[model samples]
Target: MNANVENQSPLLRNALEFAKANWWMFLLGGILYILFGILALARPASALLALAVVFACFLLVDGIFSAVRALGAKGAEGRWWVFFAGLVSILIGLYALFGPVNTVLLFVYVVAFQAILFGVSIFMFGVSIRKAVSGEWMLYLTGVLSVLFGLLLLWAPGIGGLSVSLMVGAWALVIGILRVVFAFRVRSLVRNT
Candidate 1:
C-alpha cells in the first residue's frame, strides 16, 4: 500500500526518498556482505587473528554505512536508534581493530553485542516503517536472524573459530540476500509512489 505523497509524514517521506535514492548502494552492500560471508565460510579454519581482522573490517564498514543511513534519514520514529547503533558499531569495530584482548572469548562478547544491538535497532526501525515500506518484513526477518545468531553465540561462547565463522557467515549471507531483495521492493515502492 503506497501512501499518497501528500499524506506521508515528512520524516517518512524523506526516508522513502532516501531509500529510493540509495537503493543501489543498499543492494551493493548486500552483495558485498554475501561475498564476505562466502569467504568466511570457505575458510572457517582461518587463524583467529585473521578472523579478527575480517570482523574488524566488516564492523568498520558496516558502521560507516549505518551512520550514513542514520544521518540521511530524517523525522522517522526510532531514527536515533540507528545513529546510536552506528556509534556503538564504530566503537566496537575500533576496539576490535586496536585492543588486543588476545582471547577468543572477548571477541565473542564484542561480536555478539554488536549483532544484538544492530538487530534490535533495525527491528525497531522496520516496525516503525511498516506502513511505508512493502518489504519491512525483510528487515524484521534479518533482525530476528541476527538476534538469534547473537544469542546462540552468547549461549556457547567457547566455540572454535571455524564454528564462529560458520554461524556468523551463514547469518550474514541470509541477511544480506534479504536486504538485496528488500532493496528492490523499496525501489518499486518509490516508483509506484
Candidate 2:
C-alpha cells in the first residue's frame, strides 16, 4: 500500500497533500465572497458595467484565439464550438465596446444571474455538508447571502453606472485577495511535501 501510494503521480499527490494541509484557502474564498456582497450593496451599477466591459474584452481576445486555433486545427475535437465561441465573443465585445450607455443593464443582468447561480450552488453544498464539520453552516450562510445579493441586483437592473462599478470593484478586490491567499496555502503545502 505504501509503495502504491508513493507511485502515484506527483500532481495528484500534490493536490491531496495541499488540500489536507490547507483548508484555510477555502475559508478565505468564502470571506471574499462576503466582502464582494458588501461592495455590491454599496455601488452596483458602476461595478457591473465595468465588469461587463472587462468580460467583453476577455471574450474578444478568447474569440480571436479560438478562431485562430480552429483554423489551424489538424483534427482536434470540438473545433466547431471553439470557432463558434470565438465568433460570439467578438460580437459581444463589439457590442460592449460600441453599445449605447443605456445598455449597461445587460451586463448587470448577467452578473446577477451569475450570483444567483453561485448562491444556489453554495447553498446546495452547505445542505450536503450539513453533517460534515460543525462549521458547514458558514457555507450555507454564504450561499444564501450570494443568492440574495444576486436577486437584489436583478430586482433593479437599471442601477446607475457608478454603483455598478463600485460593486464590481469590490467583488474583484475581494476575489483577488482570496485567490492570492488560496494560492499561498497551496504553495506552502506543495513546498512542504
Candidate 3:
C-alpha cells in the first residue's frame, strides 16, 4: 500500500484513500437510490407524494440547521438573513407537508416556468453563437423542443407531474448505477493497493 501510494500523485492518492474509506457509503446510497427510482417509476402518483414528504422533511431539517447556525453566529454579518431564510423554509415546509397536492401542483408550475426560461435562454445563446460556432442549429432545436415541452406541461399539469416523476426516476436510476460502478471500482483500488 505504501509503495502504491508513493507511485501516485498526491491528489490521486488522497482521492483513492477517500474512496477506499467511503466505498460502502457509495454502495449503500446507490442501492437505496436504485430502489427509490424503481418505486417512483412504478407508481408516479405515490412517487409525487413521497417526493413531497421527503422535500418537506429536508426543508424542515435544513431550516432548523440554518436557524441554529444563525443563532450561534453571534455578531456575524447577515445572520438575520439566515434566520429569515430559515423561517421561510420552515413555513414552506409545513405548507408542503400539510398541502401535498397543492405543493405538487406548485412544483409543476415552477418547473414549467423554469423550462420556458431555460428554453429562451438557450435559444438566445444559440443565436448569439450563430456566427462564431457551427452546429448552432442543434441548440436551437433543443431550445424549441424544451419550449414545446414546457407549453405542453402548462396545458396539462397532471401529465407534467407524471413526466417529472419519470424523469426523476430515470435520473436516480442512472446515478445509482454510476455510484454502484464507482463503488466496485473503489473496492478494486483497495484490493490493488
Candidate 4:
C-alpha cells in the first residue's frame, strides 16, 4: 500500500505539471476569442462573407480528405457518415461561397451550434477536473464561462454568430500564439524532464 501511494504521487504530480504548462495556452486562446468577437462586430457583413469563403475552402479540403478516407475504408461500415458529412460540408461551403450576403444566417447557425458544443465540452472538463484536485476551481470557472457564452450565443443567433466568429478568430490567433510561446517554454521540459 505504501509503495502504491508513492507510485501514484509522481503520476498525479506529473499530470498536474502537464496541466499547469498547458493552462496558459487555453487562457491565451480565450483572450484571442474575445478579440475576434470585437473584430466581427466591427464589420459583420464583410466578416461574414470572408468567413463563408474560409469555411468553403476548409470544406473543399475536408471533402477531398474524406473521400480519400472513404475509398480506403476497410470493414468499418460506419465510415459512410464521414463521407456524408464531408459531402454536406462541401455543399454548404459552396452554397455560402456563391450565395448572397443574406446567407449569413448559415454562419450564425454554425456559430451558435459551435458555442453549444464548446460549452458542453468545457463543462465536462470542469467536472472531471473537480475530481482531480481539491482547489481546482479555475476549471469550474472556465466551464461556467463557456456555458454562459454558449447560451448567450444561442439566445441571439445573429449577434451570436458575429460574436462567435470574432471570438473564435481571436481565440485561434491567441492559441496559435500561445502554442508558439509554449513551444519555447517547453524546451527545458523537453531537455530535462
Candidate 5:
C-alpha cells in the first residue's frame, strides 16, 4: 500500500484522500436528487408547487454538503469555486423557501439562473481537477447539461407547468445519476490508493 501510494502523483493522492472523507456527501445528495426527480416525473401535472419546494430543499442540502466538502478539501484545486457555488445555492434555496414566489414564471427564472451558475461553477471545478481525477468528463457533461437546461427554461418560460415539470424531472434524473456514478468513482480511488 505504501508502494502504491508512493507511485501516485501528489495531487491524485490528495484528491483521493479528500474523496475518502467526502464521498458520502455526494452519495447522499445524489440519492436525494434521484428521489426528487422520480417524484417530479411521477406526477408532472401536480408537480409545479412541489417542484419548487423540492428544489428548495435539494439546493439547501446540496449547498451544505458542497460547502462542507470544499472546507474539508484544503489545498484542493477549485475549492473556492465549490465554496462559492455552495454559497449561491444556499442563498437561492433560502429565498425560494421563504420568498413569495407565487408565479410559475418567477420560479422558472430562479431555477434557470441557479442552474446556469451551478453548471458554470461545476465545469470550472472539473477543469481544475482534471489532472487528479480520472473521470472528470462526467462533471463536464453534467455541467453542460445543466447550463443547457437552464437556457432552455429561460428561452421558454411560458412553456406551462407540465412541460417544465418534465424537463426539470429529466434534468434532475440525469444529474443525479451522474453524481452517483462520480461518487462511486471517487470511492474507488480510495480503494486504489
Candidate 6:
C-alpha cells in the first residue's frame, strides 16, 4: 500500500469513503453540469435578466450541495470553511434571485467578490485533502478557473450582458466538465474496491 494512503488524515480517509459510496452522486452532478454548461453556451447573448435568473438557480444548487457535502462529511478538515463558502453562495444566490438588476452590470462587482471568496475556500479545501484520492487535483483546477472567472468579472464589470453570459457560459463548461471527469474517476475507484 502507498504510505500516503496508509497515513491519510482521518478527514481525508473519511472523505474518500464518502466519495466511494456516492460515486453516482458525482455522475448525476456531472450530467447536470454538462446540461447547465450547454445552457450557458447556447445563448451567450441571452438577456441579462434571464441570465441572472439562470445564474441564481445555478448558485442555489451549488450552495445546497456544498453545504450538504460539508455538513455531512464525516471528518472533513476545515469543514467550517466549506460551510461558510456554501453560506456565501446561498446569500449570493438569494441576491441574484431577487435583488434588482435593471442593468447587466448591476451585480457584477458583488458577484465577483462572492466568487473570489468561494474560489479561495474551494482551492484551500482541495489542497487540504488532495492526497486522499485520485482526480482530486481537478477540484483545485476548478477553483483556479472559478477565481479567474471572478477576476474577469471584476476586471470588466461593464462588459455587458452578452459578454457576461459568454464568460459565465465558458466557465461553467470547463468546471462542469472537470467535475464530470473527477466523478467518473471516483466511480472507477469505488468499483474496484
What CA RMSD would candidate 5 show?
Answer: 2.6
lDDT of 5 by residue, 1-193 (tens): 1214456666555655676678778788788878888998999998799889889988998888888888888877677888888998998999999999777898899889888987887797777667667788998999999999999999989999888888888888898999899888878766776
TM-score winner between candidates 1 and 3: 1
Decreasing lDDT order of the candidates: 5, 1, 6, 3, 2, 4
Candidate 6 has which clashing residue pairs, if any? Answer: none
lDDT of 2 by residue, 1-193 (tens): 0112355555334334433344444444445545554655565654555556665564466456546644554333334544565566577667766775346678776556555654564455345323322344554555576577678888887777677666655554554454345445445544654
Candidate 1: regions farther than 4 A off: 1-5
State the local distance difference test value for candidate 4.
Answer: 0.48
Q: Tell me the whole-model lDDT of each prediction, alpha carbons only.
A: 0.79, 0.53, 0.58, 0.48, 0.83, 0.72
Candidate number achieving the greatest lDDT relative to the actual structure = 5
Candidate 2, 132: how far from true, in Å?
Answer: 1.6
CA shift of 117, model 1, Å: 1.0
lDDT of 4 by residue, 39-90 (tens): 5556655676676566555545545554444444433333354456456556
Q: Candidate 3 residues 1-193, lDDT tens each?
A: 2225556455444434544555565576566657766877898876786765664554466456546645654543344554665666577667667764465677666445534653564465445434333345654664576577668667888766677777656645664665566567666666766
Question: Where is the poorest 10-residue window by lDDT in model 3?
Answer: 125-134
Better of 4 and 6 by TM-score: 6
Residue 31 alpha-carbon offset, candidate 3, angstroms? 1.0
Let me know the TM-score candidate 5 reaches against the reference structure. Answer: 0.91
lDDT of candidate 2 at residue 186, scale 0 to 100: 43
Deviation in Å, model 6, residue 9 alpha carbon: 2.0
